[model samples]
Target: MSIINPALERPELIAYFLGANNYSWLHFRNGEKKLLSKPISYLEGRLPGFIRVHKTALINPDYVQSLHRPLRQKMAGKIQLQSGETFPVSRRRWNQVAQSLGEHLSPGNNEEPLQESVYLDDARPTSEQSNLGRSVASLFLVTSDEQNAFLARQVITKNWPDYRVETIPKSIHLPELLDDLAQSELPVLVFLDARSDTLERLQTLQRLKNDPRLCRVPVVLLALPTDKSVIEGYERQANSVITMKEGDMAFAQVIDRICQFWLKIAELPAHC
Candidate 1:
């Protein structure tokens, strides 16, 4: 598809595109930039060979050549296109972006079995401890991996900025975390990643739901696609048991779905 750049009275193919931040910027092979008015999300759905690596930016993977992990204060890594243009991969979407690059650059090898979202979010701004003081809703990001925790934080904070997180990788942390949340007078949501230990995690869920102070709060478990416990999650008092699928897109898709159902679609208690 083509669009007319009324500013220059010119039209161009989408191919010369480098990246977009809501509005896509096109780079002519000869080195000229034209802004396209369309939003990145719109292009992400329709444009082939492109990836949405940030909330505001969509990249043409064809031009991608390298990526650098987050710097000291940055929320996410940086992406470098073949033409040397770079864009930020939002902290929340870094895992997704990495996975996309992995799949794109190594299509044949990427066919390996998908893993549970072992990757955790690492980009939440640790500098602002004030978020914990708020009496609003809180999201308990329970995970074992650092990358997954960072990515999940990005996704959650983007939708619920006021919401704070408690990344509990160890089940040992649950009782204390939930207790603290209960006393805070904030609504709480638990996102448990149990790909590592099913039985123990189920026990953790059971203990969470049985507690009088926390029973009303929602708990969403991330289980493997084949885990039989998925059928038993509801019985264990889980609000939702989501299967963590595997692939390069696995990490990002998991975060997106969780935010959609838990934050956007579902009605949580006063905390949410």
Candidate 2:
């Protein structure tokens, strides 16, 4: 018998797995996918926490937002994830899926679909773009450096036009920022630059993580390319630590990828 380390498994980070024949596609919370050579049977035996919802699908129970069943038995049921992606639940698997989501299921109108925006990949066509209904989320770039803020804005404007960028100085009062973010009616993400006041920035990051109201909001630390800086940022509970790169073009590319992943790919928590 093999014991899976909780740290290594990080099952919460995985959304589900879709398998066919000898291959499997691993979907993540960040909207990233990985093709594995192993079959579904192989993974089902090895992974402990995943619930086999369908012949081809294995979902992490933690990510299951709800189980949706139609009024009539005309079609199969669905397992809706917090990420707004839904997977089919065969008739045979309905009982099993419901039992697995016993306590976790949201206690609203089961017949009504979530008002929150659905991904384009959803079975029901809500919109042409992903997260269409809730695209006006605020993105905060906490940096004293004007150049860094300008570069991030350019990339965000070009990639995520719906996202609004707000530049905040690192020296701002932590409590004021937290209070403002806690009252926000939309999703929020923060980018902190540690190039200048690295210690002060890390302290601010720690404070954000410690606050329960705003802890779910993703905070990415922009640190110098050093082991110490990266390690410290993680220790302070930064969601992600990206190293600062030289030159405008190179850094802009990095910012582009950042915007793509956070604003577009990753499913953010409903802060409101």
Candidate 3:
């Protein structure tokens, strides 16, 4: 698709895209611009892989420096730009975006060469699998620190032996991550840490839940204190919220619940 240049008619107009709502702004070189008032839905279909990471900017994955995963739902990783600007990657879109990055780096894509270690496990399963079921499931774990990320991976691998678990660093670019998620298959589950800020995280969750493409993907927020009021608020957008301090058995139980929930959704008879 061709890039939309509203400046064609108004030669002085500059174009800026925002992903928060998927709207673009047409600005004149003279510093005046009007919000296009178009729904992000339209742009989501036409824009290339990279998109607006926030309400005020568009990002290309090629330019991303790193992705940081925050430990709490409210605070996800900030996308570091080549220009030194930081953008937020909503917990909801983290997995999708990480998958997209892997694809981009895969052979035949424009991504740079992979390190030897990444190639060492080429034969490994890309998605998780199990004798318990036939379908493969993708899990995205959002953590605040490397230790948690490692722990989460260990838990997932031990319990859901057959599923593919993609652990995204919170420092990556949000737009790039979402682009990846957009291309993945159904039955994706995202685990968000609850220790982070809730307002921004909720906004991100709301956006992901609202997207028809990603709406079905379940989002489970991980809360430590396990406040009832907080849980209720997140439940509006999250599939479920489980406390990490609840011990290994409880953690496993929560994972099982999520697995069951997603499996049920995946098994629904298709209309198509």
Candidate 4:
């Protein structure tokens, strides 16, 4: 449970290890974090029973609280700890990690139920009832701004726990997105940021629409409340144009509504 810090020559109990490049951060149970003068690979060899969930994260099963797996395999699963910290489980490492933490994972909650909506159609037949549950789709937000990506992800995860939000920074290759989505087993929704680079994002949207593989995927444009931007977005084949709100809370509500309609009401194509 304790390891001697090579530099400090003292024993320290670690909750987990987060690695960045050559350095590793040692997180303790008391919410204390120390920058260790060693790589996570070094600690892996030294510490026993610490699970390497991701390439950059190593966790102690004793501190694990629960494991969250998506209904679809397209998105990576996450490991939540008792300290309220979460780490991503990479697709390649998922099977190994799941088997290792088999006894620690919570039961009947691996796939959390979606938040109940007032408008769910309860009249669907038993054959179609399987698809009425939480969505297995992924949302790809295309933007260069880090804050925009963070806020969108925060909003999407809060509203739809089963859906995954991935940020595709600026200068993305449309063909690459198409190829990746083509290989995925589930569908994907694209959100283009048109607030700043209106023309460029619209062009990207046009490219997406022209591609046969991605043409069926819904592409929504996040833009300012300008008439020109909205008009341009539609001309380029954007499925929907959402105007940005003044405050963070209001903006998040906007995203929440988007999730309600796209992931809840609308039926997407089987493959993106």
Model 2: weakest 10-residue lDDT segment is 116-125
lDDT of each: 0.59, 0.65, 0.49, 0.65
Clashes of each: 12, 0, 25, 0
Q: State the displacement of the C-alpha of residue 245, model 3, in Å, after optimal TM-score superposition.
A: 5.5
Error of 2 at 148 (Å): 2.3
Q: lDDT by residue for model 2 over 144-179, one digit each (tens)?
A: 666766776767766777665655554334433344
Model 3 per-residue lDDT tens digits across residues 1-272? 22354433333233334533445654333446566655545544455565444434544565555544443222244455444545655445555555555543434332332211100011223233333345444566655445555555666676677665555444123223543332433336776655554444555566667777666667777666657636654666777666666343455456566666765555432312
TM-score of 1: 0.48
Q: Which residues of candidate 2, in runs, are more than 4 Å off?
A: 1-135, 245-249
RMSD (Cα, Å) for all candidates, in order, is: 19.4, 16.7, 10.3, 11.1
Candidate No. with top lDDT: 2
Candidate 4 Cα errors over 4 Å, as ranges = 1-136, 183-187, 245-249
How much lDDT does candidate 3 score?
0.49
TM-score of each: 0.48, 0.47, 0.48, 0.48
What C-alpha lDDT does candidate 4 achieve relative to the native structure?
0.65
Candidate 2 Cα deviation (angstroms), residue 26: 54
Question: Model 1 — which ten-residue stretch has the worst lDDT?
Answer: 111-120
Model 2 gets an lDDT of 0.65
